[model samples]
Target: MEKIVISESNYQIRKARIVRTKKLTPLETLFEIVLDGDRSLDHEPGQFIMVSLFGIGEAPISVASSPTMRDSFEICVRAVGRVTKALHALDAGDEIGIRGPYGKGFPIRIFEGNDLLIVAGGLGIAPLRSLIQYVLDNRRDFGKAHLLLGCKTPQDILFADELDQWRRRMDVQSEYIVDRAEQDWTGPVGLITTLIPGVHLEPERTFGVVVGPPVMYKFVIKELLAKNIPEHQIILSFERHMKCGMGKCGRCQIQNIYTCQDGPVFRYSAVKHMSEAF
Candidate 1:
């Protein structure tokens, strides 16, 4: 076992295809990546993998594809930093290093047979997309599932083709809002929180999962708590500047919790009180 571990430290990267790529917005790009080898990514929903650009840098990216798809995985990348900028430059059939399917994912077992209220804002939907696709794939494991997605503008939407498919599905009740709308936009317009009140849910049976920017959490969480969802049942995924995907790096530490190891995913009650966790 130790010999296997030592040999893999060189971080062998498989040559994968871009397979598909979409220019969601001027600043964001979504890449559908697949491994060239026979092995699948084998990731849980909400779990993130570190995408390495070799000489440039490594960035922690959530697996945006569902575990259902045997052929490939997806990652929605926002060109906000150096590593991401490098990632955005590449396209189909590109070679990039990959290290982990690290951090804990959503608690799929606990959510079994329970209603789910999934809330995603801005780039936050990048991570939640994995879990949503999973739940939709295995719809039997969960009860009524609702997705609430919000972005800066109509053009900012990620996974547009998938979003339309979700909107058309009878099994999944999905809605989206843009903070600001253009003349052509016809969907709901407002902060994501505005759409929360309209979503009727049994607070006791429903698990509220929210993933969004730092500012979005403070307000959205307050809405979920007010809806009577238990603090522990309200789940969230946090973001930070990460270096090493392992906990050894202090870059992603939030108080005593390491975002890379202890989470990127956390229950609200466990971390709501922590400063800078927003």
Candidate 2:
């Protein structure tokens, strides 16, 4: 018998170190990580990586930083489960394993030269931040950009300072709303869908990209369709428990389609019929 040896496994984990950390919310902490050897994650916006802790296991996290950030990348973790809770305990100087910047990302080439309508809800902003930052970094390549963000409350908002900076930019039109508010709250109070109607864009020239809780999708897509955007131009990132970054795991599967491989990102036209894909 002939011997066939494999040099590497697709599941290989690269050593990465956390260089900085910030507590975004009571539930969420942001980690700034750099791969060993000065390597860039080199990931596209809306893609995700599988982060591992030797004893605790791994979880798929969206790359919160844009590809423009070549030196390091970020992942905003909400300490909701075993792996994430353990991840939150680590601070700067801790080491972890990184498996992938896997799955298809937002199609940047298709978005070029088009007006953009970016809608994010709650934790969805983490992944969408990548696309938002990319568009802003290469601002000239895109047309009018509108950002509509919604959260449970003011304090729950991620990247508050950065969101303010984006709002102040003349090139980007930004609006925010919360589902509920305190006595001091003065901004609009409602579901994120409330903010969509007033946005003015040439639907034919606009691309609508959305990411958020599963419940947010149907309603948001309704509003985007009402705005006359084509189904194919309306993009979505579906949240799934992706056990493996590769398609073989079957954990992130939606029927025959694998969210880890076929998506995390998909055009509405491609997934509208897939009942499992919210």
Candidate 3:
């Protein structure tokens, strides 16, 4: 249980070991990481960390696990680029560099007494999974919770086993849809928006949280707004190229706001008009 001590600099990296790994899909992998010294990554549900792999450079990855799970954190990665490509080559017991649980996360405190509608599309479920787990783990603190998930195909859905568990839970309600269905799949087939209308929720008491691709947000937000949910009650997490988790890089700027500093998660009312936000 060696403690991982970081230097005074905000950019200083902490050593983390991959305790376990699971190949979630052909391109995506889930890594359960334990920071040195068995430290807890006390991060809000939607915050992200900068992951470094020696000379390959670093990239921002969200904390996929809930903060309620104190021992270790999880991050889901897609092998799409240089840093992530290098990341995918590693396995359990591999040590890597980590910094931050940076950015403002989901407004769980504000949502404590409200019903929640979680909408996730494609790989967007990565970060939303944390919020979903947090709400479920603290079910008594919140009202009804509904998760509406959409992905490209049956094989592309993220957390199949865990989703099954969520579906069976009496405390949570979940519906999954895929763009293209497979022979073995029996669930609904359509856009994620289709499922939103059928959800029984009191707009005044419900908060809608959405995360997904740029295109997905357009339609999903439209549906959420149409459902009579207020603008400020709808939360959105934008997936940006957050090169530096510290917000100095300016790469993740949405107009005057730095997504790494001010957001990654923001109320839809605050960013809806910002062209670059969605």
Question: Between 1 and 3, whose lDDT is larger?
Answer: 3
Of candidates 2 and 1, the better by lDDT: 2
lDDT of 3 by residue, 128-172 (tens): 999988988888999989999999999999999999999999989
Per-residue CA lDDT of model 1 for 31-72, tens digit only, reads 988776746888888888888887997888988878888788
Candidate 3 clashes: the total is 0
Residue 232 alpha-carbon offset, candidate 3, angstroms: 0.2
Among all candidates shown, the one with the greatest lDDT = 2
Cα lDDT listed for each candidate: 0.85, 0.92, 0.89
Arranged by TM-score, best first = 2, 3, 1
